[model samples]
Target: MFSSKSERLFTGMIAAALAVSAVTPVVSVEAKQSEKVTYQAKKQETIEILAPTSPLVFKQGEKLKGKDRILNVKIDGKVKKQPVRWSNLTTSTIGEFTATATYSHKGQTVTLDVPYTVEGYELAIMHTNDTHASLDNAPKRATAVNQLREENANRLLIDAGDVFSGSLYFNKFKGQADLTLMNYMQYDLMVPGNHEFDLGTEAGHPEFAEFIQNAEFPFVSSNVDYSGDQYLNALYSEDLTHKPVDGKLYEGVIKTIDGKKVGFFGLTTEDTANIASPGPIQFQHYIDEAEKAVKSFKQRGVDQIVAVSHLGFDDNPAVDNDLELAKRVEGIDVIIGGHSHSRLNEPVVVADGAEPTVIVQAYQYGDFLGTLDVVFDQNGKIVSHQGKLIDVKTYAADPTAVSLLAPFAQEIESIRNAEIGAEATAAFDNPRDAGDVTKPSVRKNETALGNLITDGMLDRAKQMDGEVVAAIQNAGGIRAPINAGPITTGEVLTTLPFGNTLAVMTLDGSELLSALERSVSVYPIESGGFLHMSGMKVEFDSSKPANSRIVKAQVLKDGQYVDVVPTETYKIATNYFAAKGGDNYLEFKKAYEEGRVNDLGIIDWEIMRDYLVKLQTVTPSVEGRILDVK
Candidate 1:
């Protein structure tokens, strides 16, 4: 559920009108044949009122309210454009009266029989977020949404983004085939996620551009500045605007449904600066931008504002979360959120004033479709809402997406089933602990597994004509703790599933010291702290905070341990993800900017697996060589 300013005003006007309606009454007016007299009065006491030049001119089931007229009415069901003749007015004063009104559609008019019962309309909002291209139905999520569409004719299908750059299928297809899947499903509107920029920001693929060009929907983002990037600028520049991320430019979109105007907009988290290759992309404050967008929508007279945001939900009760945004921002009626992959099985209702705003999100990877059923009363204020995470697993797969994805299914299944090797015991239980990397077997400095992987990368890099002087791997990317028993290829793949390529760079001993200092000074608990190196020994103090943890950094030169001096550069090997500085290693991102990084053109997992296979029988042991922590 998302909201814009017009929605708030519409809800407010409805509430005001409903409040004023209680004092009004419906009264019938009688006119003589010779003179036409209009009875326009305060009529404060009248509860039901009907007035016309002739009794036969009135119609049944048509809502009419003058300065002071209220009538008890009910609609039996929907009717086409036609004149409904009423035989009774049912006013306290007038016993019975005859009335009729003409209804028409597409220039055709007719008369229809009137019913005694009343009927109302229902609004359904259907959305999906974080769909990272689970393109095939073998996973069963892609087919589930297609099946759910059967329930509502006036339905909206929206993706909150992150629809690119994941899985072997996407890596193989480069998003051309992924867009085809969304095209076939007919998504009405979409926003791009960080991964959408993966193709070096090129819109040169005419086929890909043609698909988005032919979309029956719009791709909206208020944050991205594309003036520098021609590829993306040509494809989606027009829809771009300055909006907010953490606190900056928030823009909302306007859409009309069933003759009632509805508005929606989206925001992505600012964390992309670290998570993806953002490259000159700028982000703004999300809440501030949202506030401005709402104010703009209010000026336009469009109501029923919905905010489709990718800011992610805040689960920690201790954090002053975005649920605060709903209460803090006055006009927004609902928030449809994603990122952080949360599951909202029911709507989180936060009271505003007379009406409360609803927040909802389904878990990620097409496991569910979030359905929010909102009913706004005659005054435009939401009376009730029901949120549901429609389980995709429950529905049988739709054959079309399944059939389209069948060919690639076997490869994925094979990868998932492949066996790697046997383990004697689990390597370590606390893989997430930053301190785990400082311990004997799991410590990046001494862990047999870490040494094994870095050695592999060095071997691969050496094959590329680059002698590996240094090698480093972030412990966080090591997924499963290597078990002591059988380790299958499936386990290895799961541990290093991200398909990151290895990169080799030339760095001075001084620069290497800087890199080590940055890595050791930061105790990243479960992330960004553990450093596995092949040619360097880094010592850090545990008593020190992460930013200043490094005690001593040194490198081996011709088998001699030399203290790192400030100006020396050394050639090093690492993964492209780290070379790009993914793990708060802004120093690496800076290094790339300074022209100090080079790609070795080898996949990280391939090297590690090869290194493990060299030994027919492998047993990992801890030798406290890397860390001399005291």
Candidate 2:
């Protein structure tokens, strides 16, 4: 009876299984009758649609069809192929295009809008450098910036800094005027030049710190170490950030432009340590810092890099410059440079690395606005570029900027128009030999202006220290020209805008000789360290080597020139910048460190103004004070 029951139960179970199998296929067919239902069932809450990476390039006259319209649709990490149709997909023109791609399966559809270029992605950059606080043309620069920004959607405006000293505006407003205009123009980024630190030693960079605090844009400083400075340390960040805050400083920043990532970092010249009063702030090796920046950006998946560099275009190779930085380091795409006041009308291409790097600079003052249009492929490599300098004078002043500058201008006008009870018979031109090498440059050769400046410094120093025998001024400290007319306080302040204090140093004849050697080290090539003398005569041979170039050094004692004795001590007057070892004056630095230097606590412009008043009518001339025998 148990065996019979088991056989019956097994037969019944087989019949039930066969009945279910027959209905299962029919039910499956019915469920898949609508393809939309099947797709929805496979669709996940999270879907990733992968398209070709941007900077997508298409050849001229190419059609957007076939495999180009395909996308990888990923659901739950499983990818499947899907065909897409594009709207407004025209490739006949060579420019950027925005288009939408639609994917449809049965009754289900999804869409995505993307931007691509026909040939390559075009990026427009507007840059300025070494503005030197010449805010008179700020309105015109604003006009140019506004027009350029309006012309292109992909654009950036940047500055390679020195917006501190040079004019009455900086003397009175202390960079606030420039900052106001820079804010109006909407600058993207900036790097500090040497002159930005001019007030560090005297005022501890109070105005500069305020300038940074009030700026509406961010500052990048990859090689400059602000940690040593109490004021700047609080505002500086060593990390690379994707989201940068205005009125702050960073080592590096990542910017997103049209779904592409671009990296920017700042590099101030290392010469700042010797040339400017950075106080306790320090500078690092540019190459090392630059390499680290590039690597950090690369690790963050940023390929396009720009360096807002205060290093000169082709300055002293022994120190640091943009050209050297580009060659020594890799992965730098563009360099917007300043310092040395290079006017690069066209972009300079350096192709020493795997990819080419482009360098550009606007000349000193607010005269020109540099513009560069660079094209990049999908790989973020610069393939083609065009660069040019737009004369800011050509553009009419922006009315908005003008209105913003009105109050500052009114105050500056009153101060600049005040007469100093002096007149010049001839225009005291401050010439530079950058374009014409044969011409005499105030930086490379002696000038009447230099003489007058040093004479004033000597007069002031002698009043304080009777034993002061001579005075000297660095060529870089001499800024603008004096017109042939009534001398105004503005002109004097503009010419000597650094606010340097008069200093007297007791140095032996040998030490003075060493300072002279350092001054003429780069003889014919204009050097900021070049010395302009008063109460002294120096004759050097240009053909001879730098250290031993001085043939004869004489000091005026009681209206007579006497040969300098190597062991004899002589009291010299010069600006505190020079006495403190500025412009690489190591011997003077040693004297200062040894307490042989006394700062007179008087402003340089004040000395010049007072001396001008002393001489009501002056006719200063270059009188063979400095001669090159070669």
Candidate 3:
């Protein structure tokens, strides 16, 4: 599924694994006689090509999706030690071929059999996903893209999206930093990720729709309906699939790759509604729209189809993931996906039917670029495939990329570098307060980082708007840990990279209790909805059942902790995402429905910065704010 630069990865007991694998047949035979089955080793080798010595195999033909024809190398029992060095095991046509690898390490001579069965052939496609406005990584990604372009002149470069709202780069320039670098890479196409609408989705300040208008390439989306908003429609006019809310977004573009037509369309995730404010824009069912797009492309005589998707992928096909899409949608050849940050070393081929759907997704934050080598048979059905997730950090920052980003970098450096506060000798965990300082997890249980974030949110709400009682920050919004030195704005930005705006809402004490119950439902299992609250204390028992986990909760009022009255309404401030029912906060959603929510334009990180600045020196330690009752 994933090919990488030749490096020995200490994954598992490699020698012991091979020994058991060699005995599988005997075990199986004995099992049949005994009427019992033994477990098989799921461990895989970490062997890679040390150099670019391997030559291309198979001829280019009609292209689309199918199972990955993997070339598995078999180790002979006669050979005990094998060298790491291996070279060209090329096949111009379909057949079984043998290659040799010989190497010596630490006085051990090694020999192994490198076997190849040519079942398919190669399309060069380069893609980025969940870039998340990591400015430093963007240039490196650009460098990697350049290298990939040089290697394959006919390669297709694209982004799966979420190229917005993270780090100081986004905090300073919105998303221009990522856009400039992506434009520098000369991406052929891109889709809008959920974070693109984080700035409240109105046709107002921090408008991604307007910013997208300046992009060099087309931004396509077949499912998200922008027809309700005239501004969104105009700003995203180039998004071929925009105006028409039909399952088939009339924007599928067919490109001539080696004189073969390759169709590409975009599909945003359905979860965007729950996670972001898309204003008048609405997302359609991805599976339905994706199928319709594929049918449309097939009707247009497009042999190959690529879906640039932002719908998150999961190991479970039952969820609305790329794997699910691949299982249901047979015609889509390749799906470049984002959202959920699945790092696949090899492409996932779902062989649910006659044709397998190939799914590829790189890890988040532009650290790696996904490169899939898909081989098609004579009829254009995918016969075999190989995938490589290229590490962008390996490449140097291109000068052109550096120059293009200079202005934005300059604008941010002064403010971001300013010293905000200092820790008193102890290094604060990036809020990964999972009881283990080394591991750093805030999603479950209580955390010092969550406490600090809630305190900041509470302070900001009180300062910006009146009648704000308490604040809660979701663990997912905390991005980085602060070191035990002078904490700068840059560190704060990284720590709270989402730049979530504050939203205040009034909910009855019973509703608040319900929200807290939902927050701790997955306690100890690390749910992002885990709430860290200011001006409140939560004492829950995880041993209890969900929705009834909270035993006792108290809200701070007039410098006193009082029992939450079910009939009493309390003003609560939280990040806008959670205010709009993100993290399944149905109570908050209910309040939004009743028009009890007010979203202020104040940025979250700035609020934290102000809080830290007011303190002059901050040493946020875990207090008994949230308790887990045994």
Q: Rate the local accuracy (lDDT) of all candidates.
A: 0.57, 0.83, 0.71
- CA deviation > 4 Å runs, candidate 2: 1-117, 202-204, 419-450, 454-487, 491-630
Q: Tens-digit lDDT track for model 3 on 350-419?
A: 8896777788999777889999877766445787788889988888988888888888888778978887
Clashes of 3: 16
What is the clash count for each candidate, in the order shown? 75, 0, 16
How close to the true structure is residue 271 of candidate 1, measured as C-alpha lDDT? Answer: 52
Please give the ranking of all candidate structures by TM-score, highest first, separated by commas: 2, 3, 1
Positional deviation of 233 in candidate 1, in angstroms? 1.9
Of the candidates shown, which would achieve the greatest TM-score relative to the real structure? 2
Off by over 4 Å in 1: 1-121, 136-139, 198-216, 237-252, 315-321, 352-355, 407-491, 495-619, 624-630
Error of 2 at 305 (Å): 0.8
The local distance difference test score of model 3 is 0.71
Best by lDDT: 2
TM-score of 1: 0.52
Model 2 residue 509 lDDT?
94
Scored against the true structure, residue 476 in model 2 reaches a CA lDDT of 96
Model 3 residue 149 distance off true place after TM-score fit, in angstroms: 1.3
Residue 308 Cα positional deviation in candidate 1, in Å, after optimal superposition: 1.4
